[model samples]
Target: MRKLNWILALVLMVPAVVLAAGKTELTWYGHSAFKLTTPSGKVLLIDPWITNPANKNGKEDLAKLDKADLVLITHGHFDHVGNSVEIAKKTGAKLVSTFDLGKALATYGGYPEKQMGFDTQGNFGGELNLLDGEVKITFIPAIHSSTVVAPEGSADKDIHDGGNPGGFVVSVKNGPTIYHTGDTDVFSDMALIAKFDKVDVMLACIGGHFTMGPKRAAEAVRLVHPGMVVPMHYGTFPVLDGTPEAFGTALKKEGAKARLRVMKIGETLTF
Candidate 1:
């Protein structure tokens, strides 16, 4: 009887152990900076411009960050490239980006050359199984321009080619599939993203002037047909005038089925 009771207790605890082992978390640092914590505790930063103007906790967040597995950059824009070098150096985080962008960043953006190599770099339509296969990242194309120039230099200084811009579709094992739009205008091919994998969440750029506005973003959302949408890359500058309220309204008009999740700065959403 005692042995049977112990066996029952162990069986009962198995589900709880599995649940705890599969927890994932996401944290936003305003603008486009986001940190993804996998169930296995691997940290991935997406376009980690932690010091952008919209995030008041930028300095604190950057300083407190201790461990990061991968730092992913969408483009070479100053706003998008924020704090990645600092974070990578401090944490020895490997960089995940396009081969072209990785070369440019290492040569000019001050990224440690050893940290970014072919191991974590890929081009559009390429996929990488990383973090012990706990996360599968697929590169998706984005319509945007990228330029790399020396910071704090004369206006006429040299501008380096930053390569093609793109986004990422991160599929977490036993978790969710997250699609980060990066910075881009809405294009027709977005409809194909959902065909490959059902997008659980989309980190989309709703800001105008540089990227698509709310109306077009809603269209993009409709195309991808994700389970939920999280608006990003808006209101960091005066020119980026897109608003979440407007995005919601547009989504409604476009008949997009995804739910909207407007996260407050420094707040986290767990799954």
Candidate 2:
């Protein structure tokens, strides 16, 4: 039965090989916008402001997104909201956000009311296994403000309170655990994130005037202790003057072990 034993050994190796082949592709679309492609081919967009000032191919890129499974919004700001409403209508992506923000977007903004429900919405300290167990998302607190403004040139120009600001810790099956620190300043409790799960990638905002600057972001990086860090939400306007170089310098000063990954707009990285 030596031949039978050899066949069984080969069969056992197949699953390991398949698991190793699985990869997650992460694409940044300028500012705080990111697209996550899971190993199972599911698509998730976070604050997808694809048409922001930084991306030269913003229009083309936005047009190409035909199949988004989920859209995760960090807060209610215009920049963070970005082109989510348009993308949702185009792809029928379910909105994953706080209950308050979901209501505001559906009421005042253009998010599909039918697609947003209890299956997707959540608040801080809550975790949900989604995408048929391909992903786990947990909401984390962020120190920021959120407001939903009417579209430009609207007659009423009504402003509404969005909800509490927060971030996301997304754990993908057979992939990396990514932390999107949706516009927030450095806080001491950020260290607790690593206590719950190991963060493979951290998408952090480094712009000074609005969110925390480079130095504080570096400290945040140190607290979370992710494998890599990608800076975002900077250089979009004259007020947002934080630079990647400054962030890198501050990271070095903080003695953080995470690798500094500076992504050019529209660039994708596989993990």
Query: Highest TM-score, which number?
Result: 2
lDDT of each: 0.92, 0.95
* Model 2 Cα shift for residue 223 (angstroms): 0.8
Stretches of candidate 1 exceeding 4 Å from the true structure: 1-21, 151-156
Candidate 2: worst-modelled 10 consecutive residues by lDDT: 148-157
lDDT, candidate 1, 50-115, per-residue tens = 989999878999999999999999999888888888898899999999999999888888889999
- Please, what is the TM-score per model? 0.93, 0.94
C-alpha positional error of residue 166 in candidate 1 after TM-score superposition, expressed in Å: 0.4
Give one clash count per candidate, in the order shown: 0, 0
Give per-model CA RMSD. 2.5, 2.1
